[model samples]
Target chain A: MTAGVTARTYMIVGAEPEWWYRDLVSCLQATFGTVLARAGVDPLSVLGAGWRFLHLPGDVRSEEFYYPCPADESGQIDLGSALAPHHQLHSRWWQPADENDVWREVRETLADNRLVIAAVDNFHLPFRPAYGDVHAAHLVVVYGLDETRGVVYVSDAMPPAFRGAVPIEEFLRSWGSANPSDVQDAFFSDSQIGRRCLDVRLDAPPAPLTPELLGSYLRTDVEAFTTATSTRTGLAGFDAFAAELVERCRAGDADALRELYPFGWGMQAQASLHGELLRRCGRQWNDPALAGAGRAVEAVAHAWTGLRFTGAHGLEDPRAAAADIAHHATVLRGKYARAVDAVGTTAARL
Target chain B: MTGIAMSSVKAGLCDPVDISGHRNNTAISAATETKAGAFNVWGNSFAAEYLPAGGSLVHVDGVPFEFPPVCDGPDNIRAAGQFIGVTPGRYDWIHVLAASERRCEDTIELSFADGSVDAEPLRISDFWAAPAWFGEVKAFESLVMHYPHHVQRGVPAMMWAQRVPVTRRAELTGILMPRNVALHVFAVTLQRHGQLA
Candidate 1:
């Protein structure tokens, strides 16, 4: 560590965070993936360890990085745990301690050799495709803060991927943007940026995944899907969610359609990753049933396209879209049932 | 060009199917007025300059295709349970130029000239800066994506060359596309089995 109390710059010693990304993932998983990589864990195995359906009614946020993470019994929200249920990952949202100096927490985190995931408005970030055109909430990795040079090093793995220095002023504006709604993008707008940042901590390194370990996780997930719980969970939970979605669409509730895009993303990304992981393990073990099960899970991911885009296109005149909306929802439900059955059977053997 | 050259020499190869009657969606747009094209929900579309001219002949992997008209009118079919009748013939594979709202794999039912029917897999990758996850060829790419209001750089829009197998030996008659709105088909060609064995 640098000796001087107020060093001009602070950066992690060896290398920048690995850019872990997939086409289906949101900024939420992309940022967490980078953090998990820096902690010496394979981001895919940890992030894709579990898959289940979760939609908290009236809890959806209009942000690109929105993920459905329900608060715990004690009312604590851990996005890290939500993303990586099988790993010892935890995350909390925080803002600058002092309104006068917003960089205080960021510099401290950098000094501690931890990368910060800051929420920024794409309209103000010059590297973002939406810069100066659309106000969408997004996430980026902040590796270093050079107060002396007036630059903030940032990394984003989304398309037109960028990794370089951003002027501190530009960064600040993006981080503090109101993210007002624009006609161009109705899905990811009208959310306040509020300079929120995630403080992620990998309390313990993940253990190497084994067949038995993965099997247990799969079993737990299957049981969760099969068992009826007080909260929205399992196939029953999905039924309730789907029913309400169709009913709301017929009633012309725009918010229901709006929430589906971002909320559905988390579920879709989880299924894709988990399915990919299971397929990899099945190939290594030469288990055809397991491989088929993985493919089934991937089908669940692909089915999300039908439902999500239907909601997206059907945003206006949702009443007109009700039939097709119900159609995709039913199709997606069938996919979930098939996938869960296949995964359950395979897990029993593994 | 090598692909196009190979297309001219191949024997009993896939004859490009003329399905102009099926074109119902416009996925390509001019930069001057980007709002005309609505390929996906975000009002993004492929750039016309980066693609073949309207009504041009193009080939990918030695397979011939009639490239759709660009920005002129309906250039693609946003699959919504559309059924297209094909020239009745025995075929080995069904090739298509397609892009999805996102990565998608759906089914397309093939009705044989006889009584047999089979559901073939139709997979298309995302046009919005995504790799072909289902082992498809990168057919065409617009280096810049067109948004509703402005041109977006760095995010390239892609069109893929994807194919589905015609395992049945009977002559093919028609294709019943899935009700998937996410899958967009620009052009299709039927490769006859006569070229093989």
Candidate 2:
């Protein structure tokens, strides 16, 4: 061991990631939003411009950041492409190349002036509410590292928004946590952190959004919803998914409810952002019908709350919760139908 | 906080209602025993330190309200379709101290003496370190969130003052809460539309 050698310190060159937050989004969107904002792009325009209903059955993970990333044409999973189907958002998960010296990749990333989005366990992070208690899988941003001071500069846009340094030992533990099963948080626990980090890149700047441009996106999404596919997608796909969910609940399958929370979050957040963007555009463009359609879509987002929470609270006895689950699912289906109809009409005019 | 108060509270415009009987959820916890609270599925709660004395007459923007108990049992009403009978009178607004598991928008039925029922939108923002998305008044904020096992700093738990419009001119009978499991009501005050209201 080189005891007398100075410890290396690396940090992104004068970059303070902005906090891009919404009540409905998880850490995945928030971290990506921050990175996108820092790259001089509006997060909503990229992440919320287009929306589709895709429920990859048996693919939902027990993590707050779980979003269905369908296999690409080349057989590789690219989450960024899935999240922003209309934009050039590229992301891929990676780990430390050198197992013995894990900070090497981070230093190189920092040297290249890039922020790292790292998966972490909430139990070891001092800022998390679950610190020293539950072990839920979460994500945070790492912008700097100082080996000499033994601290890593991190930022988390989640509740109690934090932007400060954490001890290297504590940060490493959280980053590399096994994230074992915890009864406290059924949806976000049981996923290993594995010191995983996401390398995000915005390949190109988004085109200026206009009524005609947004109308095209809306038409595309509406077509996606209406058309049938081999994968779980669109209105027909949603009906099948909801029917199976209700059937599973009636059969007392707890796994169905367990999967609902994380899966529903992605859909809810997408609707929320898309609706917000539409509303903002409608007002700016003085289009009353578009604004009303935006509100309808937001209602769809709000409707997810009822279904998701009902499924969450009913985890103990799925059979007993079937009626309520079925009721909420029916209500949500109605909302999606109405919202799609409204957005479809509005898009046609635009 | 100041901006939140502007949208939520109407000074000298509200009459505090008797809502203690409707309290069914305990959302505030003492530092010593944080496990007593079960506000959400995860058992997170607001800290008692940053709140008012239990059952005190507190005012947000001059609107008086009967603050619920602190570290006491059942400080808020976890909405479950409970019908709250109100004094028969005409009111313009129904101010409520509330929060939600997430951002929620639902309807609360207002019953009138004419056998009429009107459902008004009841929108509340998330209490978990969130901004006022629904333009609610920030009534009280617990600087630190209380978990079942520990008191967590930096994650502030918020209480909001939101309102529902009572458009009917007829005599109000009772209010029917929504069947949503995510919404919680801490206190309610009816604002009389008249000069003495």
Expressed as tens digits, the lDDT of each residue in A109-196 for candidate 1 is 8888888999999999998878888899999999988888889989898877888899999999999999998777788899999999
Local lDDT at A271 for model 2: 90
DockQ of prediction 2: 0.65
DockQ of each: 0.73, 0.65
- Candidate 2 ranges beyond 4 A from true positions: A1-7, B1-15, B193-197
Q: How far is candidate 2 from the true structure (C-alpha RMSD, Å)?
A: 3.8
Clashing pairs in 2: none
Query: Which numbered prediction scores highest in TM-score against the true structure?
Result: 1
lDDT (0 to 1) per candidate: 0.88, 0.88
User: What is each candidate's fraction of native interface contacts (fnat)?
Assistant: 0.76, 0.70
lDDT of 2 by residue, A248-307 (tens): 999999999999999999999999999998898999999989988888888888888888
